[model samples]
Target: MDRKEQPLVSIVIPAYNNENTIIATLESIRNQSYKNIEIIIIDDNSKDKTLQLVTEQQKKDNRIKIYHNSTNLGMIGNWNKCIQMSNGEFVKLVCADDLLDKNEIEKETGVMILNPSVNLVESDTRLIDINGKKTGSFKRYHKSGLVKGKKIARTSIIWNNFFGAPVNNLIRKSVLDKTGYFDEQFTYILDFDMWMKIACTGDVYIIHELLNSFRIRNDSNTGNLIGKDRETYVAEHQRLVDKYAGELQLNRFEYAFSIWFRKFRNAAIGIYLRVFAK
Candidate 1:
């Protein structure tokens, strides 16, 4: 396809203090098969060399653009900043520590091109360690096809998985416009809330191929925030449930069951991390 014919994809990276892994993140975007993309990085007052590394990469590639915030806006704030800066039809939020396979853009954007109604699409993703080694692997919930918006929300709440992180997904900017920005109240599960909010508006498409890498560090946001704040995590889960209960059409029985089941699951994960995780 000609350059003009292709839709511009905005790959937004919201960085905080990710100096060690920012280069790999930039390289993954630089190697994407789809050419017409603008890489937007918003540095949230990083005390490390995260901005310096991104600035170096920006010099090499014209598609890369870097911005810095005078004050720390936190995670959700930084994400909203990325959205405000992006001018693309499609927006993908990639973590500063994660990696996208070379063909991820080609394939995921293809899904959007073929299915005009799909406002969101996600690919399978694997977990990697700090050294970039594949530490674990598993398949996501949905198969390769289009799923109804309500069904996606139902499955997410019933299973309590929230699909996966935003790194595994490409979202339509129009849908985001309807849903608005990420809510800062959610310390954790912000990505999950955004996914559900988008899914409520239109259909969600899934590509069952593993095309992204999510780094698992002990100090990563999930490990540092969600891991330490189980109570807050549970509260956030309940808040989302209350916010979307009418949209999900969930009854009292279903809501109660889901809350307890998710609590049990969280407890099990905590036990496993304490007993087995290294």
Candidate 2:
């Protein structure tokens, strides 16, 4: 069906100097078997030809809408604006440099609409190199299973993020409406914090499918901040553990680990880096 004839889904792509990969990213979403989509390309004051490229794509497809911020509000602020501008019943945030699997939205949305209780639908994702080449293997946090439907409880997210990043998930607008948007204060772990908050509202259902491609760019924020981000992530998480130590029995072990094991892991990383020159 044509986009006009079907239910619309607003896809927010926040771009900032993604000239190398943004075109491929938009193509993936455009090529999705699910035809009805309104892609909002919000330019975050990109100095590169990112805006120029988006403008060119906009002329090619009416379904593609373009918006530019007066000044760069960064990803968090731009995403908030995307949510405000969205007119779809469902919402999906696809980074300008990331690619969605052909059936990602159609598959995940079915799970949400069918399971009324499930507000968020997460799926398995694969990592790709900068050139869009497939990387080695499966993601660590998304446990392997034929789990057609499973809710992500608060415990699930905290444990996973403390272990790894949750990149390939499709969330409902309702979840965002209830739990609120990403915390801009957290430049790094915004998604992790938001997921934990979302899980508090209810269970996050996991649909076992290769839903999207997570790009592993060497120069990205995560890669750049790995050293400090790792320390900050652990410290902040340990702080959270301490704050909720009374309520969560699991926190008892976490607090203990915060003192001992978490430090040991950091020490181990230091040792490995020194030995391997990472």
Candidate 3:
């Protein structure tokens, strides 16, 4: 695609005290094969030098736009801020600690451009530790293609969030606008909830390739939620099942099974993360 013809993609990073990994994350986006992108970084009142480092990097790349919250909005609030501030054909919310492959945007954007019916495009993700070493992998589909939105929602409700994190997905801004903002009520499953909402509106395209690296740090929000507070995580997931059950046409048996299955799934994943993800 020509430089002028390529659609602008907004890469929004909701950063909070990610001083140790923010630069590397920014560099990954800066080096993307897709050039027509606007980097929106919203810092949630970090005590560290996250703002300063991003400011310096902004001088080097004019495409980067920085915003600092007056009061800390927390994770979900900061994410909603990034979505509101974005002005692009497609939006990607990449965590400050994660890294995207150079061709991540290019590939995901192409999929969306070719298929206007697709509201979201998600690819496989590589799991990396804080030190940036590959630990494991996260993938859902064995093949790449479009999946019905309702099908994904039903499957996800029964199983889990196979769509991975926000970094692994690209969403159409128009669809996102219709879907509305991320719900702040959700602490751990905010992205999962948003994905289900988007899937209800249109089809989802899945790419089997590992185009993003999700960094697993002990201090990250997910780490804290799943590691320190399993109760809240389970509660939020159960809430999703309840919220989507009727819309997805899940029967009482399916609904009951989903709730029970999630507990087992979470425990299995916790063990995997503890044993294999080391």
> Is 1 or 2 the stronger prediction by TM-score?
1
The candidate with the higher lDDT, 1 or 2, is: 1
What range of 10 consecutive residues in model 1 has the weakest lDDT sum?
Answer: 269-278
Off by over 4 Å in 3: 276-278
Ranking of all candidate structures by their TM-score, best first:
3, 1, 2
Sliding window of 10 residues with minimal summed lDDT for model 2: 145-154
- Candidate 3, residues 1-278, lDDT tens digits: the string is 88789999999999999899999999999999999999999999999999999999999999999999999998889999999999999999999999999999999999999999999999999999878889888996544699988888898888777777999989999997687999877878999999999999989999999899998765677676766677788888889988988899999888888888877877776665665443
Q: Number of backbone collisions per candidate, in order?
A: 0, 1, 0
User: What are the models' TM-scores?
Assistant: 0.95, 0.82, 0.97
lDDT for each of the candidates?
0.85, 0.66, 0.89
Clashing residue pairs in candidate 1 (N, C-alpha, C atoms within 3 angstroms): none
Tens digits of per-residue lDDT for model 2, 1-278: 45565567778888899999899999988888887788988898999999999899888888898898879998779877877788776778878778887888788766766776666567767667776777633443354422322133334323444223333665667668776887666766666666666655654566555668777654676554443456775665565555444534455555565445545555554443333332
Q: In candidate 3, where is summed lDDT lowest over 10 consecutive residues?
A: 269-278
On TM-score, the stronger of 1 and 3 is 3
lDDT of 1 by residue, 175-255 (tens): 876789898878788888888888888888888888999886646676754456677778888998898888889999988
